[model samples]
Target: MMRSCLFFLVLLGCRTLAADDQPALRVMTFNIRYGTAPDGENHWLKRRELLADTIRQYQPDILGLQECLESQGEYLQEKLPEYAWHGLGRNRDGSSEMTAVFYRKDRFALLQLENFWLSETPDEPGSMGWDARITRMATRVRLYDRQTGRRFTLVNTHFDHVGEQAREQSVSVVVRKLSQCPPPSDEPVLLIGDFNAAAGQSAPYTAAISAGFQDAWVQAAERKGPSITFNGFKPVDPGADNRIDWILYRGNIEPLVCETVDRSENGRFPSDHFPIFALFRLP
Candidate 1:
C-alpha cells in the first residue's frame, strides 16, 4: 500500500509540473486610437462597446495600449475587473493620450511602475523630442507572476507618427533605460507599441533588433491574421506591408503564437489599428 501511494504522488507531481510549464501568458498590444478624436461615426462612444468586447474575447494576461486617453483607460478598468491598468499621459497635465499597460490582477503583482518622456529632458513632462509633432512617452512596469514565481518588465509606448529622427532617438532612449532598469538586468523584458514604423523599413526597428530583443511576430512558431496591423478604419488589405505595431521580447520567454486581430461588426472597427496578440511560455 505504501509503495502504491508513493507512485501516485510522483505521478501527480509530474502532472502539476507539466501544467506549470505550458504557454501560460497571453499578451496583446493595441492602438485604440485617441478617445476624443473627431472620428464621426467611429467615435469612442460609438465603438467603445465593440472595443471592450474585442478585449474580452482575447482575455490577455498582459495588455499594452497606445493612444489611450485617461477616460478610456478608466472605462476599461471598469469593464475589465480582472486587470489593473497603469499609465501617465504625455501632456504635462497628465490628461492626454497615453501608452497604458494592463495586467491580470489575479495572476500578477505590480512591483514598480515608471514613465519617462521620449525627449532630451526625459524627466520633464510634455517635453517634445527632435521633430516630433507632439509630446511622446514610454510606460515601464515590473510585475511578479504569482503562479510561475517569475518577474518581468514591460515597456509600452507610442512613437511620433511624423518624425523619423524622433522615432530613432526614442528607441535609443528606451534601450538605454532598459539596460539601466533597477531590480537588476537579468529579468525577462517585453516592448510593445504602435511604433509607426514598419519592420525592415525603419531605423528604429533595426535598432531594436540590434539591441537583442526578438520581434515576437518573427519568433512565433505559429501565426494568424493579416500581415499589416493598421487599417485606418477601412477594410484590411491583405497584401499591405504597413505593419507598424509590434511586440518584442528578450530573456527566457518563448512566443508560441502571434496574431493580428481584425475583427469588426456591422462595418465598424473597434479601432483604426488592429490589435496584435501573442501567446508566450515562461520557464
Candidate 2:
C-alpha cells in the first residue's frame, strides 16, 4: 500500500491549477513533530524524505503545519519546491517552532498575512497566555483563488497543549478575530491545526463549533481509515480516542471527503500525528 501511494505520487506530480477553473480545494493539517525532539533514530533528518513524500502522495492544495522548526521548514521548502509557505515562530525572535501554512503558490494569490499570539497581549510575539506551557500563535493569511476568483481567510494554529483555560480562550480569540474582519458569505474561511484537544471536547473545540466553523472529519460523508488521528508513532490502537487534529471551515463550504493518512516508512510514522486530507467545494 505504501508503494502504491508512492507510485501514485510519482505519476501525479503537481499540475498547474489554472487561473480560470478550479473545482475544489484540498486541505491538510499535520503536526510535523519539531526537529529539536530527541526521537533518536526517528529524528527529522532521518524522516524528512518520508515527510515530504507524504505531502506528495496527498497533494493538498493548502497544508497547515504545527510545531514546525526553522530547520524543518527549510528542508521541506527545498524538497517541495512547488509549494509556498508563510509563518513566523512564536518566539519574540522568530526562531522557534511555528504554526505554518503552506499552499500551492500557483493556485492562490496571497493578499495579506499576519501572525498573532494566543494571548491577551496578542501583539507581543512571545507572550504566553493564561497558564499555557509555552507561547502559541495563529498565522492568518488572506488568499485569493485566481481560478475561481474567490477570496478567503486561512488560519493555522496550535493551541496550548497544557493550559485548559488557554485552550478554551484560544478558540474564542480566533473567532473574535474573524468576526472583526468578516468575509463575504460565499467565500469560505478555513482554520486547520493540531488543536491538542479531541473532537467534541468541552473547551475550544466546542467554542469553535459554536462560533460556526464546521469540523471536516465530523461532517464528512465517508470517513476513511482509523479513528485515532494521533498515534504517537505506534501502531494505531483501534480503541484509542486520539482525534485531536482538525480542518475546520466556515461559510458556504461543503466537505466532500475526509481521510486520515496513516502511511509509515517501516514502523516509523511520518509524525506523531496522522495528517488529514479533506476536499472542500463551495456549494
Candidate 3:
C-alpha cells in the first residue's frame, strides 16, 4: 500500500508539471519607423537604448518589428542580447526595409526561417508587385516553446503606405504563404506588424480577416478606446484615432490579454507608431 501511494503521488506531480508548463505566452508588435523622424532628429543610434529598455520592460516572448533597417537590427540585437533576431536584407532604394522577429532564446527555439517579396512572383526576392510604390515583403518564422513543447508560426510585414493596390496585394500574398505553411495542428499562426491600414473597413484588414485570421484587439472582451496605433508624438488623449498596427491569430491559440502599450512615459515615442501586445494561451 505504501508503494502504490508513492506511485500515485509521482503521477500527480507529473500532471501538475505539465499543467504549469502551458502558461500564457506574451507577444508584441512595434513599427520602429526605420529609426527616423520628420524633425531631422532621433536617429537609430540615439534611440537604441531607450527602445531596448522599453522592450525589456514588457519582457515579451516574441516581438515583431516593422520598418527595421539592417543597421538598426544589428543595434537592437546588440542591445537586447536575450533575444535572437531574423529578417530580410535591405532593399535597393535603401528604404522601406524589412520586418524583424526577435524571439526570447531561453523560451523558444526557432524551427524555420522564410522570407518572400510581396509581388506577382512572391517567391522572388525584391520583386515589386503593383504600383510604382516601394517594395514590401513578409518574414515568417516557426518557433517551438521549450517549456510547453508547443509550437507556433509568426509572420511580420510592413504594407505599402501610399499604394492601395500594393497593400491589398501584399495582404493576399501573406495569406497564401501562411495557408501553404500552416502551423501545427496543436499550434496557431500569429500575424503581427505595421499593416499601415485601419481595421474594420480597410481593404487590407478585410482581406486578412476574410482569410480566417481574428484581430486580437477587436476581439477583446471590452471594446476599449479607438484602436489608434500611430500616435506620431501627439499627446496621448482620447479621440486620437488610427488603427494601422495589428496582432492577428488563427487556430488553437487564444489571446487572453490584449493592450496597446503607452510608451509616452519614456518621454519619447519608441517609434512613430505605438506598439501592441497580447498574451496568449494554448489549449
Candidate 4:
C-alpha cells in the first residue's frame, strides 16, 4: 500500500509539471511595405496573395506589422479570420500608414488596446515629433493567454525612418508608457516592430537594452536563416547583418528559437522587408 501511494504521488507531480510547461508561443514582426508604393512589378495587388500565403504558412500566435496602410490592414483582416487586430492610421483623419497588432482569436483575449504618437504630446493622435520626416505611432495591447492563464503586454511600433532623434525618443516614450502601467513590472512584455535602426549600430537599440529589454535574437538558443531582415525587393547577401526589424522582450519569457524568414515565391518576394519570428515560452 505504501509503495502504491508513493508511485501515485510521483505521477501526480509529473502531470502538474506537464500542465505548467505550456507550448512555446509563436510571435512574429513583419514590415509589409505600404501597398500604395510605386514599386513597378512589386505592386500591392500583384503580391497580396503571396504575402498572405507567407503569413498563413507561419501561423504566428501574435503578429506585429509596420507600414500597413488602411486598405492593406483591411485586406489582411479579411484574409486571416483566425486573428483579431487593432490599429489606427497615423493621420488625424485616419488615412495614413499604421502599426498594427494581431493575435489569434482562440488563443488570446484582448484586455486593452491603446495608440500613441512618438512625440512630446504622445496622447495626441497623428502628432509628429522632433526631426521626424513623417508621423509615427505605436499600437499597444494587453492580452490574456487563455491556454496558460498569463497576462502580458505587446507593443507594436514603427519608428521614423529619417529621424535619428525621433527613433531614440520613440524608445524612451514606449518605455515610459509601460512604466505607468499598474504595478507588477515583472509581467511579460513584448516589443516588436520595424525600428528602422540596426541593432548595435543605433541609439534606439542601445536605449532598449539600457531599459532591460533583451533582444529575442540574442536570447534564443537556436537561430535560423540570414541576419538581413530587409531586402528591398532584391536578392541579398546571406552573411550580411542589416536587421532593422526586431523582437525585444522582458520579464518571464524564454526565447526558444529566433528566425529571419527569407522566403520568396519564385522570382518574386513577398515584401520589401523580410519577416522575423521567435518562439517563446512563458516560465
* lDDT winner, 3 or 4: 4
* TM-score against truth, every candidate: 0.91, 0.90, 0.86, 0.91
Candidate 1, residues 137-235: lDDT per residue as tens digits?
999888877666677789899999999999999998888777665445556799999999998758999999988889999889998899899998999
Clashing pairs in 4: none
Per-residue lDDT of candidate 2, residues 50-135 (tens digit): 99999998898888899998788878989998889876888888879888889888777676677888998776778899989999
RMSD of each: 9.1, 7.9, 9.2, 9.6
Residue-level lDDT of model 4, residues 1-283, one tens digit each, is 0000011111111112224466568999999999999999999999999999899999999999999988898899899999988778888777788888889987777776778889988888778998999999998888777766677789899999999999999999998888766426778899999999998868999999998899999889999988889999888999898889999999889998999999888878899999999998767
Give the TM-score (vs. native) of candidate 3: 0.86
Which scores better on TM-score, 1 or 3? 1
Give lDDT: candidate 2, residue 94.
Answer: 87
lDDT of 3 by residue, 1-283 (tens): 0000011111111112234566678899988877554544455656667777878888899999988877788888888899999876536443447788999887777777787777887776667889727778778888777766667788898888888888888888888887676666557888888888887889989999988889988775544444688877555666766788999998887787787776764466666677888877767
Model 3, C-alpha of 24: deviation from truth (Å): 1.1
Candidate 4 stretches greater than 4 Å from native: 1-21
Measured with C-alpha atoms, the lDDT of residue 149 in candidate 4 is 65
Query: Considering summed lDDT, which 10 consecutive residues are worst modelled in model 1?
Result: 1-10
Off by over 4 Å in 1: 1-23, 182-186
